[model samples]
Target: MKKLLFGAAPLSSRAADVTWLLFRLHLGLSIAIGAGWSKLVNLTTATEAEKMVGGAGSPPDWFVQQVADLGFTLPSAYFWAVLAVWGEFAGGLLVALGLGTRLAAFQLAVQFLVIAFFWYDKPEPLLGMYYQQLLFWAFVLVTGVGGGRYSADYWIWKRATARLNPPAARAATLPAIPVAG
Candidate 1:
């Protein structure tokens, strides 16, 4: 019974590890290709974005004017738009590579926040902003978990530790042999 249980344990653990790797790959690809790609491809114009933010409507105009009235310089609408696009672009690439996931997620989160802030008057324009936040937080969570089990980080760490401890490496490489009386 013990042998059976022990034999199954490693397989179960390996399956879980593979699942985690798949999750990271899915998340990274979605962020890089689905979300980031769209932004990067459409960063040049802001006419549509400005209209969505209520810039042409009385409610958004009043909101913008109120901020401007307070002596705060209203940011050029395009500035915020471009910032979001580039932040998601670069951050998503970094996260996809597993090189700097935390920093990339942080930048993406901030970009979402900025977009949310500017478009608060037009909830329709900010409909999917929270989803971006959720994705960013998910990335942050995975970053804290240290790049999952089958990552470049794991491979590099294993190689470095093996190089630093040759005796341990040699012991690990030796095959087990059964001794008979």
Candidate 2:
């Protein structure tokens, strides 16, 4: 790999962590533009289903009818649509900020899964599909672990751990207690 890259050095864990953080930050910011920001700007009504989907070509009337025929609740449908859109927006924001990364990434991952698998006619077949797949995997990573050292999750974890477990130096400074027989 290094030979093919014109004497480039292998990336270290620190570099990888930085790269991961940057990758999520950039992707989250970009996704937010359309997925998050657009929906937010247009959001006025709590039950506005049409606003969830941007541009033209919302699901056909026949499809809606079919869903209804299958006993799909109208309010539930709208509620989910609005939820997904807001989730995308909120997820992107949280991921970018490295706050609530796991939850945000999980939500985004589910959103992409629905789009890539349910929405796409052929799953993982095209470059676009591959992009979504990669993004999904990346989100999964963030979900499973987190945004790494650069994230708020990391800071919170470190603080919590420090509070839970004192440093050796600090522990050594404490007076020894006599044990009760």
Tell me the number of clashing residue pairs for each predicted model. 0, 0
lDDT (10s digit) by residue, model 2, range 1-181: 2111111121358888788778878978877755555555464445666765765323334434433443558866655555666677778988887777777888899877766656544565556677777777778876776666777766766666567678986889899999999
Predicted model with the maximum lDDT = 2
Per-residue lDDT for 158 in model 1?
57
Question: Scored by CA lDDT, what does every candidate get?
Answer: 0.53, 0.66
Top-TM-score candidate index? 2
lDDT of 2: 0.66
Q: Please state the error at residue 102 of candidate 1 in Å.
A: 3.3
For every candidate, C-alpha RMSD to the true structure in Å: 11.2, 11.1
Relative to the true structure, candidate 2 reaches a TM of: 0.65
TM-score for each model: 0.53, 0.65
